[model samples]
Target: MTYLVNNPADFVDESIDGFVAANSNLVRRVPGGVVRATRTPPGQVAVVIGGGSGHYPAFAGLVGQGLAHGAAMGNVFASPSAQQIYSVAKAAASDSGVLLSFGNYAGDVLNFGIAEERLKAEGIPCRCFAVTDDICSGPADKASERRGIAGDLTVFRAAALAAAEGKSLDEVYEFASHANDRTRSFGVAFSGCTLPGASQPLFTVPKGRMGVGMGIHGEQGIEEVDMPSASDLADMLVDRLLDERPDGAASPRVGVMLNGLGSVKYEELFVLYKRVSERLEAAGLTLVQPEVGELVTSFEMAGVSLTLFWLDDALEQAWTAPATTPAYCRGGVALEGEPRDDADLAAAHEEETPDASEDSKSDAAGMLAVIETIQAKIEAEAEDLGKLDAISGDGDHGIGMDTGARAALSAARRAVEKGCGAGTVLMRAGDAWANEAGGTSGALWGLGLRSVGACIGDENSVAAPVVAEGVVEATDAIMRLGGAEIGDKTMLDSMKPFSDKLAEEVKAGTPLRQAWRRAAEASQQAADATANLAPKKGRAKNHSDKSIGHADPGAISFAMIVSAVADTLESLHEDAA
Candidate 1:
């Protein structure tokens, strides 16, 4: 368990501040994360690595001269927001291009992929590679479905080395992908990791038992077995990895990583490595440089994982390259003084919005009140929502909703008070929602709000039919952005039906408030219906059967917010009438 914490809510933020301060010589603080303090050679492809916090040396600890140029840190066990990813990437970029890499998790994929698109849109070249190396997460044939664990180090190191050599983004990406293909990792856990401030760990292991093939993010292991001795555990890990060695390897030269996940100590890892090394040698496989320590870690997870990185000539050279970072420093390399401090790491400016007429601005104020209502409803149901998510997914939905709603409310209030138009207010709120929540739900909500605002425009008070159209546009945008269909047991399940019902009622000449009320009923019904659905997207994919009796948190949250909005709209319309 994580014992040293003041406020669990502020754990990550406080940790980052202290971490940057401690490693100031190697890294400097940026708004979204940290970038190397040492200057990079101009035209070097910047390697930006990141994911949720709590994995120390895997990310920020690896940022320095020859490793990652920057790390886009996020919430503990959550993906960094797209804005955060963009901020770090932009800060790290230096004319050539930016290559983003992270573990292949749903939140990280959505957030990082969006940031990459935004960077490209702004003419800053960006490419992303997700490290999928844990063999236990999926079948051998479905390697792409695997989660990245201890193997993140191998892929990120290879990519960063290629980038440090001033290789093009394409070459760097290929190197990373190759490294991912060659790397395979498996883990055993004696206990689960506890997040800061959480009373219980994400999962548990019975005393004298071990969880095999566990995920780093407190994802419960696929199988459980009787606890074994250090040598036995080591043999198990080594044998499992050996069973799925990369095909067509002429030589058995491999780089091995014995990773301690949080509570596991160096003594334990080195002891286990003793047996692991013996097993490899007994199997006639030649071991190259072996790193036996915590390269990546979870917070207070009593477990260890072994990564086998099959090496070729190029990979061997890359692996042996001297890279100096705060945590993993090797041979000396030339370094110029730090470049000029970034001018725009944190966005101090407001987003641009369309001009609004007086009536439109007034309506935006009304919308603000409606959003407040929605936020209150979310706040009230946050814990329940999280419980719903925990049934089949990471128990983060409640926290994510609270974070996004609060952020959106804050942004919307500021925009409305500044006399911004409705479109501007909604757009700003959407960005805040995505930036603060930092998950799949966050991205979907962001896209939905932005789409609605884009449809509404800024010149006039939104009519019922126009509002219905905006809702439909939001539904379409969310579907396109998240790749989730109506039956995917996502927010789209509720939102699509609500938008459709609203559109149908508005077309039939129903009053806007009444149309919204009618549509909200459909939304609630759809949310309730999700209890019977097995999730077809996100983290719930592997645990689809577990979700059969629980409604999707996203769908429930969307239904509640829309219902609140309907109430607010009905009250406002009655006052106007």
Candidate 2:
């Protein structure tokens, strides 16, 4: 179902109003969807930035005390009109002159250039910095002609800071050009975004696929490819960046950003970062600083963009300068460094020393038995979850979860047999899960399992009280890492309450078997309660109504499988007795 906006025709105006309202201390709109920071005094060389509204931080959110002086906003993915650009320029221009900056697109070039000429006629000096950084957006020979993506942040920030620092308009223009020269971006879309108040998507992508090099606004990409693991995607993006080699040093100071479209989860972003880091290191690139989040997004789109800025002292200083905006802000100079040495890498890759207890055949067998059961359950449910997911959300959830669980199970068995602690097993399993599984849910599941394994550690056996405490602790760990709290209609809603209940029962001196049974029941009840919860976070949040009546599949399956595991644990205890 489509969203019920006040009016489709006035959507851009209304959105701009809300943005100004929320950031009144920093921004105000001039005529035409153009906004300027309240602090920007007229007559200082002004920096005008813009393109579209949906990529929040892109055009407007980057306007702040130390950033752009103004932004011209367009509807959804459309380029801002020529009039909008002129208005913003007029509003921001001072005796010093004005610089118009935007992504390099045909529409933007035409409109902004028109505005530039108009500003000249008005006796206001103006220059333009049209950013083009996406390697996937164009061929190698014409890579500099590709569409702008996240790399615009670095370029714009450099120009804005220079202007704020009292640079002449010419100087600011040059500064921005240099920054653009050092920046490169690439992106992949799992699914497309939707226009406001629209039921259908703005574009379509096939299931279990990704449009590599897709533009932020649903433009056609270099090619559609089968979805790959985070590592694979990272490798592809990094390889492209390295191949193109943004202007400057053999080993440039790099700023990396794994930017999500509006609806991607933090968990998935982290997984992407983890792989990106590895690939960057292998390529002999130094990571100066990194940003990961939904900074620039298409409305409710499922995708990610990787932006790399080859840095210099000037660019580095500007990026670190404090500026508060709606969706983009950073403070303090970020200390930067290169990847670790080969010795460190080798040390990390070395085989682990075995634990004494794990040398026993029975202990190894027991661990295998537990993991095998978990693996079987995941394999069995994979198809069922996929079918359920097909109706409302991306159908990858089921496949992703199953893949994650199986990976975790495999890692756990191997670690345990190799005489590693449960904590080690969990950490290793988490890595495997993230590497093997696709989509957001896999990352969440991997994180949760890792936390649980860390809490359990090397414990061979636990009393009811310890088990209860461990479960509660695991829940807390998940909350911290995933950044999702209980009752957010996430997996934690079901897992946390049930674990707490288990602790309560154990504290009452209930038998391990009985406490587990109670926890299982609590888990089931909590999962059911999620059916009434409006999703306030994650992938499901996009469809507020669709998620309202249905239990979050992640929560449901987590509760069910955990409850079953607890049941098995109880049975094992009974058999031992």
Q: What's the TM-score of each model vs. the native?
A: 0.93, 0.56
lDDT, residue 46, candidate 1 = 91
Model 2 ranges with Cα > 4 A deviation: 1-4, 37-39, 332-577
Cα-based lDDT at residue 174, candidate 2: 93
Please write out the lDDT profile of model 2 over residues 473-523, one tens digit for every residue. Answer: 767755654556677887888888788888888888888778877887888
Pairs with steric clashes in candidate 2:
43-94, 43-95
Candidate 1 colliding pairs, count: 0
Best by TM-score: 1
List lDDT for all candidates, in order: 0.84, 0.70
Error of 2 at 530 (Å): 57
Error of 2 at 167 (Å): 1.7
TM-score of structure candidate 1? 0.93
Quote the positional error of residue 55 for candidate 2 in Å.
Answer: 1.1
